[model samples]
Target: MAYFLSSHITSTLWKLKPLALKTTCVGSVLAVNQRKYSSKDDAGSEYLHRSIVPTMHYQKSLPRLPVPKLEDTIRRYLAAQRPLLDDENYSNTVKLAHDFQNGIGKQLHEELVAQDKMNKHTSYISAPWFDMYLSARESVVLNFNPFMSFNPDPKPEYNDQLIRATNIVCSAVRFMKTLRAGLLEPEVFHLNPAKSNTDSFKKFIRWVPSSVSWFGAYMVNAYPLDMSQYFRLFNSTRIPKPKTDELCTHQKGNHLLVMKRGNMYVFDVVDRDGNLVKPTEILSHLKYILADPTPAPVCPVGVLTSENRDVWAGLREKLLEAGNREAVQIVDSALFCLCLDEEEMRDHIHISHNMLHGDGCNRWYDKSFSLILSKDGQAAINFEHSWGDGVAVLRFQNEVFKDTTERPLVGPTTPPAPIDSASAVQRLEFKLSPDLEHGIAKAKENFQAAVSKLTIHAMEFKRGGKEQLKKKKLSPDAIAQLAFQMGFLRQYGKTVATYESCSTAAFKHGRTETIRPATTYTQRCAQAFVQQLGQHSVEQLQGMLDACSKYHGQLTKEAAMGQGFDRHLFAMRYLSNSKGMEMPNLYQDPAYTAINHNILSTSTLTSPAVSLGGFAPVVPDGFGVGYGVHDDWIGCNVSSYPTRNVHEFLQCVQKSLEDIFTVIDGKPIKSS
Candidate 1:
């Protein structure tokens, strides 16, 4: 595979000799045509919202994601490979870049520009990028799906499962109302260094988007009974014939799916009058489900979701044939999923087991939001990342928790209605054949096997948080990213190509840009700590720290400007697929594969009030590291396959952060 750089590559090849304020890497210098940002005094705040927003109020004025000039993208692509490649390999990649820029790259850029013009009325990358995401060959299980868990609320009343589930569903409805009302402020991602450029930044900034697709659909994992074992069973008239087209769960609908103890229930969050139900009403409905004592025959249908995408798609079609079309409609129409688990889970490991693939019976993993409340009242959300990134979901979760914690929980003073009268909630029964029953049994075994291989470590670093970084005049995200880099270095004695998501959400419908975090400055900082140890001066370390932070900031701004190398690369590849063209040499180069094979996939979700969820490693050899930066403490969750020792790596991250404090404070060293 061809290696490509992301952004901010300078042409100058100056290496660090003695520590300096700014250290330039061996790459093309990033030309700064400093665009001034517009301050409120100059452009006025009203100019920010000048355009008429159509559906989503803040979306109308935002600019479309730009296609970078071929020369710049090619230059960046080459520069990114310099650090990872040997001299010979680097030279080969450079030549390949020349071949691409002059030959195939020119043609592809022209086609993309034409395509961009066609999508000028809409986002150029939106549809193409989404389709491409669906075409990936890798398993979506751990890599693509990300989850977050909220710690127990301060209120003791929430310990009652029914009360917690009700409040959570209501909180989600409140968020949904906010989304529909367009009252939630659109996120601002660009850090415009100058005030004059602010207006331009506002005009072109990427922002957290409001997408209809993310909210109302269930991600259906469909699997059929094993063909070899039940060839004769297919001839039975009782079985409904399966079709492949019905397998996908991406379509959106209007109902909610609630799963508990292998039983599935369908209910409407809205009344016939189109008004959302009250929290009291929702609580009453959940209590009804809790009162039902009959155990549901385990439907292993949910486990098929954890399988490969193509395989699940096939199985979903078959599962639908077993009298589940109506059930599917209810699932598709629902706002989201509510998982009512009777089991208690206090630690991250146990929470992960339930959230990731709970019993393979009570979860329908297809929905964008799957809210789970345990018997002990611990809550978490399992989000399918294909619809949006962590930031979008984090925003929703933050608001829900904020509303829950701030408001008083008051039950109705009047007597409640009997459970039998409420037709709002109904249990969904699936008529599964004996053959399908066998499939369910097999799926459960497979799901258990998958969960057994996963290793999770949930640790809280009480040492320091965002406030500590503020005191050091450092970006909290930057310091955490560096801590991850240092941890990786300590564990493997080398740095892997790292990915830290940078929001491009300043633009219309913007999601994220890959901010490659393993910079030359970070490399040197890690080297200084490992090789020099106590010998490195504070000035030298400070210089490195400043350089790393500045570079990261630059990357963020570039990503916001749609200059991210990854998306452009991804778009170009998708174009080739669209045109039925062969894969370019730039993509086929070894360097490309090396970088894309990410060994360290990390993201930071900060919500001062809640403990965010964690996810599976993106790759078999990698680890999924998510950290929450609060006022006084940092909550970290590290997960990997059974083969990798994430616990040790997390310990290293803690040590690295402490060591950083020691260096910044000029304190005496204590060897751990």
Candidate 2:
């Protein structure tokens, strides 16, 4: 989920409010002791911290997300608009914004604040955010769900499909057990892990009550994030409805759902006592499914999930009416879906395509998530967006990757246990009427048409990266964002609206806030390098880079703190629509529509466990850019529809990065 609000009128019917704030008063003695700890972690200790305290210990005392004042939101909103609009259009947008803040927006803001007081459990954006996703009429395949690919194992032999799948399944069950037992580590950002991540600190914090544990952790500058979405990680599915969808989770399911060649199979991974079955048993069952000689179904029912929400809802009703209720229940109540693809990935482009949407027949797009592995052992996760954000998913991935790689339960030489494989694994069979079969056929056609229009490409910049930029005292993220601006300018000779998603998970039940990266500073700096190269001195250009970095840093902090303007403005508009009030002139302005369109949708997620991540363009003529800035290189995996030139765009981005590196290295700017 990029935090872009859908412009569909039906999606604006929900009311939203911020979670109530919680204040803790710690004794002076503790405060003095906390001051002795450093906020910087020792080298390589950042990922060493483990959860000694219970997982939900910080839930009660975590502070609520704040509501920015109407004036501040207006100011920030206009500042973001200024870079994307011309002088005449900006003047018009300014008047509309002024009118809104002083008029109906004031009342809307008041009502939003009052509602925040009434609803104390979730952040202001939660309800509307959910509404934005569930209410979307498009299929979740490309328009909504995203994929993150796991890096190939260090040991080449471990990449064998059966070996990797067995290990992943076992590690996944262990993760579930650890989480259910409350022994899993809480997600935290340790500014200085050397102090807060020590055994003594963990022992002390373990004794603190759950209600006040957040305060204790905060004293040492350790920030624990919201883990409310973790519970939905297993045994969950998204059920389609006429106008919206609901997230369904069953806590008692013991069987695992496996799909291959459009056929469904189920086998028990958890015993009756809720303990994970032996890894040997899991391996045997998986081997049975893989060795089955059944061919692909003539009418693969799974593709129906890739249909439009309303269409899928209607087809689902037909399935139930056709006596497929038990089969549907088994799918919905299974622990999780594990997809075993028959084809091997050919390259990075093939990996992106295969992992993202895949041959629609072999995928269950409505599952809370799916762990997919190809025949060649390349693995990735494709997940439903409405149930949760990447925070929960990434944490789960990190743990699973660590467990499977570091302490794998199954090895290359491990043999499947001698057992009755046929009786152990049950193939799920659904009765289908002719109408349902026709629906499946149409769904396959639609899925093919939709995914066929997409073009994906990948690029890597080895000239410079995070380390090089850090040495120059520039934000690596800022430099990356600036590269996008310059790249767009160099390709299309214009600057457009861009979006970067920032997680607001520091607060209770928080979602995301939009980091509008196309700012006036970035625009000016991009123009200097892309258009006026050789006209400016290297020192002056370096100063511009510093300015862009500093401003971007400020934007990132503001968004993380829930002080960004986009969500606030979105909430107010949602409130207005729910109350049946006429749309505010500010929203009616074309400038508002253009900004929300977000031509360049970008998000960054860097993890040791992840090789790449990607999503499709949100609009027909846009780019879905997933990028990472590693120590020595920056990589981008981008997708586009036919309206855009993805290949040329990446070339421009690469050139822009090279030019920026040259300027940083005190070399003359290359003439365009």
Candidate 3:
């Protein structure tokens, strides 16, 4: 249960002598050279040290419960809108549908193209949220591998197993399930009204999240445990029984598909000796994993850092040039962080992925930064958030990018940036907060009840409302695109807007709260998009649209979503889970190690430039990162269209708006 050493400054006593002994409250510590401390020059110092601290057994847990499963919450709140396989005229949404497929497909190719830059971070990129949620969920589900053996002994001083978190910004994660599965045929998550698989789709919705959670649990639960040995999973346990492993939709009559109803192209990667493998290899095996079902799920794990900013400069130069021969001019917008490594295994480090996550690490740091180099000599940034909220995340990313680049948008004169230190004043620490643990516990019960209700009807369940949404149709900008592309489209059109879907079912409140922001943003965007439809001259309209976006962003009807900020505070207190939620945000903390693994990037953004990370997606190429983003829905549907490609279409539509604007005297049109 231990994840950290006490916050009481262990430095005061250590200042008197250089002691090599390890101290741990919670978490792990690699090996220590006890012999070095046994024969210290000053016996008096050793005795003093022993008197102040006693060697002890670990008997506590990390603070803070993991992010909760929102699937049941999603289903219950979304009851009004049907999520069926045939919910939409998939036969009709060709442009958007094909684009969605193409967007992911292109990313597949890019995943290969930029394979070197990717590592463990790729899979994290695949399902950032889901993956994090899974790590935490599985930690408990499988008892957190308490029996699993690690090589390093009692180096809790190196790694107290605490989890540090960073915010995820622009990403291509929604289709990761399908992408990982690497389906040969097109598989849609939204209902397909053209097909009668409504029952199947509904069943999928009901089953997928749980299955995903279990798969992670299976990984943890089923793994081999040799207390004196190392980590190995699946080899100890087989897949569950027919009922246990039965998936909702595989189209193939057999229920053997592991990632049923979703794409399962990516495979799990491991070392030849059957250990968790590196991210670089996982990415290499992606092609084969997509083709073969026998392989395990792949994870790409590697870390990058600003510590070796020089090395990154070289690699970035090479990567930027890796593209077509056209000089690959890139408008780069990068977000970075200063990872403070307090303790762990490698250089005293831990966690997953590239600088995107895993890069913020253990041993590779000086108070200012870490330059942990991989075999390839790339330094990984330590301390990037793997656990901060979107806004908090972006705020930090913006700071990192701004500081690293020497140019900040809030203007250099903005208040000195605050660090997300363990000592950071709690963002929401209010003195008079009431005890809502009971309500939160009740919410969890209700959420579980909702999930069970649907799971019971697993084979026959059907989500609702697709037909109506389909009838209303979606606007061009509703589609997602690489943000920069959306920016470019604005040069041609008078208005350029992005769409962000609110979590339609996060809190107990149904879609109403979710609906409010979507409506406000949608209306404002409509006004802007219509006015610019095919416009040529934009100096004036552009100014107005910018003004309107700023105005619209002020709408806070969707503010209630923040109610569950401390999702497991009550659960932890009641169950006596005893993990401190405010443990330092670091990579070596095992706390950071267990995170949502199958998360596909989705977010709630009101502003186009408002990156989930704040600084916006860096346009490596002239277009956005993945599909030409017309808009970004990630996976939320407060807007009818939700793919990056839809935004691509909107960007093009912006051009048409420019042309139309010339003819319409710069006035946006009213809807017919």
- Which one wins on lDDT? 2
- TM-score-best of 1 and 3: 1
**Who is ahead in lDDT, 1 or 2?**
2
Model 1 Cα lDDT, one tens digit per residue, 143-210:
56666677667777655677667766766665555444433333322122353124443343223243
Error of 2 at 606 (Å): 1.3
Backbone-clash count (model 1)? 49
Query: How should the candidates be ordered by lDDT, best one leading?
Result: 2, 1, 3
Per-residue lDDT tens digits of candidate 2, residues 165-203? 999988888878778877666766555677786768877
Stretches of candidate 3 off by over 4 Å are 1-385, 390-555, 560-650, 656-672
- Give the range where candidate 3 is weakest over 10 consecutive residues by summed lDDT: 224-233
Per-candidate local distance difference test: 0.59, 0.82, 0.21
Model 2, stretches more than 4 Å misplaced? Answer: 1-51
**TM-score for each prediction?**
0.80, 0.93, 0.23
Winner on TM-score between 2 and 3 is 2
Off by over 4 Å in 1: 1-55, 137-139, 181-254, 408-415, 419-424, 668-672
